[model samples]
Target: MAGLVAALIVGVGLWWSSPVSSGDVHRYVTEAARQQQIALNDGSLVELNVSSDLSVKPTAGERRVTLAAGEAHFAVAHAMARPFIVTAAGVSVLAVGTAFSVRLGETGVEVLVTEGRVEVARDPVDAATSGGGRPKLGVGERTLFYATNP
Candidate 1:
């Protein structure tokens, strides 16, 4: 009985030492001809361009943002244990302590890496499943993603 109790305590301690989970409690939106600067709970900064909409959802071991429209420049805080990911137009961009910009247009999605590195992947399909890793974009690199008509 004492051994079982010890094991339970260790298990709980390990989980507690891990990253704690958080939810999307903050949201920001910009109107036409207007720009806004938002500060997240985790000390990250987001410069929202005109006519942009985004939401921040922090989960266990990861921080997520859903960009519904327009463009934004993000200066993420350094958190190696928790990756920051942005989803726009069915595309995902993962970063850790990076500065980048993402623009969603009617034609396609555009990403610009200003600092650090980021991994980009097309959504709805797991890149890892095909044994192909997601493409990594380094600083000063830019890419455009356009979906093909099936």
Candidate 2:
């Protein structure tokens, strides 16, 4: 019992000494539709869906956002210091100074590249956990990755 207490104390101390994680994981995020302009801390704009949820900011060096279950249009600010990554289901859209829309649904995922270019990566499984962007998609291109043939 004494050893366990000591270990717990040490773990707590170490955790307190460590820096905070980069991203802020927010679920069930929402706002008005007609407005269609959500501002980021860095002056970027994201027009979200009626009731969409996503996570943002994984590290100080980069701006990462996850499309948990809806669609979002991004008007990204030009920041080479921070690359924007939008992960929806099994697909991830990586952009720097681009604008695009990403949607995640029960069928699959779709990415409509409007402005800049982005990479559309596929997942072997029905869900995605960890992987980098691949298979680049340029402007005016739309790519879809099916989860179960729909």
Candidate 3:
């Protein structure tokens, strides 16, 4: 009975520490006129701006975040095996270990890299109308992606 109790305690401890390891999806939303900060399971940090909506999912191969609306700054943790990716509108930003901000606006999506580097690309379905190119942005660089109508 003592051995069984010890095993159960260990299991519960592991589960509580890494709930996202079970493929859980975490969502965060910021209220209007307010900002919020979120710490991801992988040690990354995100600062969500006012009226922003963000969803985070950790998969076996990568860490993904979807910005449904508003803006957010990402301070990604370094995990070479799993790349960090952020998607907003039709644009995708890929970063291995970087700090960047993505904003979804009325006319387009804007990406600003404050540290490290990131690869910005348009979704394949919108490639034709948006052009084709994977632009790499370094620290202090910024790019604007025009919104496309489906």
Candidate 4:
């Protein structure tokens, strides 16, 4: 039984090492005058407004995205195996099979979760003033943290 198990493990490792298929997490749309929507392999959809930049990376470990600039709406699909993470400005939002939208600018940041739940973490903009890094965001809520000194 031990020898058989070892052989099986080796076979699985070999199979995993072989070439595998790939899929795009989200499509990149830049400098658009209108709205842009992207459908992902995980059934999630992202809608972007004008003058925006968003990058989606769907991998086995984690489904990551970045809203570099502008506004975007995310309709994340249900996936227990992987979690969805979005980072914009100095803030990071994490979702577990939920839908939400995020808008970031020089003023601050905004996050709205339409379904499921999400976690928001504050970015360390200025340690001297704010004391430390970003704040922790809870589930089923929205918050706007100012970049001002306390």
Best of the candidates, TM-score: 3
Q: Give the TM-score of candidate 2.
A: 0.68
Q: For residues 9-89, write the lDDT of model 2, one tens digit per residue.
A: 788754432323433743335533322356777777887776566666646767778777678899888887677778787
TM-score of each: 0.76, 0.68, 0.78, 0.67
Flag the better candidate by TM-score, 1 or 4: 1
Better of 2 and 3 by lDDT: 3
Arranged by TM-score with the best first, the candidates are 3, 1, 2, 4
Q: Pick the candidate with the highest lDDT.
A: 3
Rank ordering of all candidates by lDDT, starting from the highest? 3, 1, 2, 4
What would the TM-score be for candidate 1 when compared with the true structure? 0.76
State the C-alpha lDDT per candidate. 0.80, 0.70, 0.82, 0.69
Q: Estimate, for each residue in 22-139, the C-alpha lDDT of model 4 and write its tens digit.
A: 3664446545445667677788888887767677777777778888888888888877667777888767777767788888767777897777667677642221222233444444
Residue 81 in candidate 1, Cα distance off native in Å = 1.0
Better of 3 and 4 by TM-score: 3
Single out the weakest 10-residue window by summed lDDT for candidate 4. Answer: 124-133
Residue pairs with colliding backbones in model 4 are: 122-134, 122-135
Off by over 4 Å in 4: 1-27, 123-140, 147-150
Candidate 1 local lDDT, residue 87: 87
Q: Per-residue error at 107 for model 1, in Å? A: 1.3
lDDT by residue (tens digit), candidate 1, 59-122:
7767888888899999999987778889898888888799999999988889999999888888
